[model samples]
Target: MKQFIQGIKDGGAIGIGYLSVSFTFGLAAVSSGLQWWEALLVSMMNLTSAGQFAGITIMAAAGTYIEMALSQFVINLRYALMSISLSQKVDKDFRAGRKMLLGFAVTDEIFAVAMSREGEVSSQYFAGLAVLPYLGWTGGTLAGAVCGNILPKTVTDALGLAIYGMFIAIIVPAMKKDSRILKITLLAVAFSFIVYYLPGLRNISSGFAVIICAVAASAIGAVCFPMEEEQEGA
Candidate 1:
């Protein structure tokens, strides 16, 4: 019970951070022609800022279902990896079905908080970690969607970068601690730019472009920056 309480406390910061970013997403969605309720629904169902942004961009552009599905898949591939890593941190006796449900809420912030916990994590703790962020994200989206055009352009533009700020806060500290992480991060950036600007590739659909960049970057990291497992007793 103490641990579960701690989990909710830990998630407080994440919830606050998500509120602004997801609010921008709601505004963007409506600006892209989604009904206000539709924007809130997307936030509630998807709970992924990047994937939702890409999917909505495609929808606004009249992209196909294949494009939406594939784009979301490519963007959310990291969550799958995050979920697998989190499963290893959970208590052995935790129920499988419960863990599967927890996996649904495994955003980057939630995964980081859960993994940083001092001991084996309980499903209850994980649930506490996920709930507030879910409310903040969904509620913020509803607010933004309702206020879509009312917010000034400059304010919305600034809010749109909140997610990038959140990512930087996560990545910068990790990169400072590990050179390998820095290298992989730089490689992903360079690889993405190439995909975006390069000839022929520039013409690729958004979904395929994301898939190609993500897969290529990950493959490069796996081969060039593989982690060496620590020995049982160094």
Candidate 2:
């Protein structure tokens, strides 16, 4: 119980950090003509900043459902990898159902904090840690949606760029540490478009194309930039 409380306290930072970015998501959703409840629902349910933004971007563009799914998969692939790493650090006794539920809380910040703990993490601690952050994210989105109605059109228009700003905020710091990420990301984006241009490839389903591009890019990255230093903790 104490650990749970402590986890919640730690999670306050994650919640606070999410406020501004999730707020931008809300604004973007409204700008794209979605209802406030829909924006809130997205934040409350999805909890993925990049994936949700990409999805809304596709919707605004009148893109097909396949396009939206593919774009989200490409943009959010890192989370799947994150969940894998986090699973190793979690309590071995955690039930399958518990692990699955906790998996939803494995945002970048939560994963970092949970992994930094001194020993195997308990479900209680994780629960405490996840709840506040989830609330903060959804609350921020609702606030932004409400603000969207009253804020000047010019200001709301500029907030549209806020979505990109969220992307930059997440990417820039990581890019500084590993230049390879930028290269791989660019490679993935470039190759992922093949299904649109090549006649034979154009016949491929968007989901398959997305899977191929992401898997190939990740494989090449794993081979080319083997993480010896990170693994060795050097």
Candidate 3:
């Protein structure tokens, strides 16, 4: 119980951060033709910002199921990697079922906090940690979706850019600390630009273009800056 409460306390900052980003997602989703409740539902079902954004974009474009599935698979591949790393940090008795449930809540911020803790993370503590952020994300979506029409177009447009700022905040510090990440990020950006502007290549759908750029960049990163065995195991 104490651990649960402590987990909640630790997650407070994450919850607050999620509120703003998810608010933007809410606006984007509704403006793309989803009902307010539909926007909220998306947040409830998926806690990932990048994946959710991609999914919403695909939906708005009337993209196919294969496009949706492939886009989500590529964009959210990090979560699987994160889950694997976190598996090493849990209590011994944190069985498969509990692990599966906990996996549903493993956002990047939550994984960072969990991995930084001094000892093994208990199921109760993890559950508590997930609570506030999930609620904040969903609640913020509801607020944005319901109120988006009431706000000025200028205000909503500004809010939509907040997601980009959040992504920059997540990557910039890491990029500064690690040249490998910096290089890979730049490579991905270049690939995206090529997809956006290059002749013939520009004909690729947005969803497939994202998949191609992500896969290409990641494959290059894996080959060029492969993690040593020790780092991989960590």
Q: What is the C-alpha RMSD of each candidate to the true structure, in Å?
A: 4.3, 3.7, 2.6
Rate residue 199 of model 2 by lDDT.
Answer: 81
Give the range where candidate 3 is weakest over 10 consecutive residues by summed lDDT: 225-234
Q: Highest lDDT: which candidate?
A: 3
TM-score of each: 0.77, 0.81, 0.87
Per-residue lDDT tens digits for candidate 3, residues 201-231, read 9779888988888789979999998998566
1 or 2: which has the higher TM-score?
2
Task: Give the candidate number with the greatest TM-score.
Answer: 3
lDDT of 2 by residue, 42-139 (tens): 88888988788877777776777878777777777778887887778878776789988888887888888998999998888999999889998999
User: What are the runs in model 2 whose C-alpha is more than 4 Å off?
Assistant: 185-220, 229-234
Query: What are the lDDT scores of the predictions, listed in order?
Result: 0.80, 0.82, 0.86
**Model 1, runs deviating above 4 Å:** 1-3, 151-203, 228-234
For model 1, the run of ten residues with the poorest summed lDDT: 225-234
- Against the true structure, candidate 1 has what lDDT? 0.80
Better of 2 and 3 by TM-score: 3
Candidate closer to the true structure by lDDT (higher is better), 1 or 3: 3
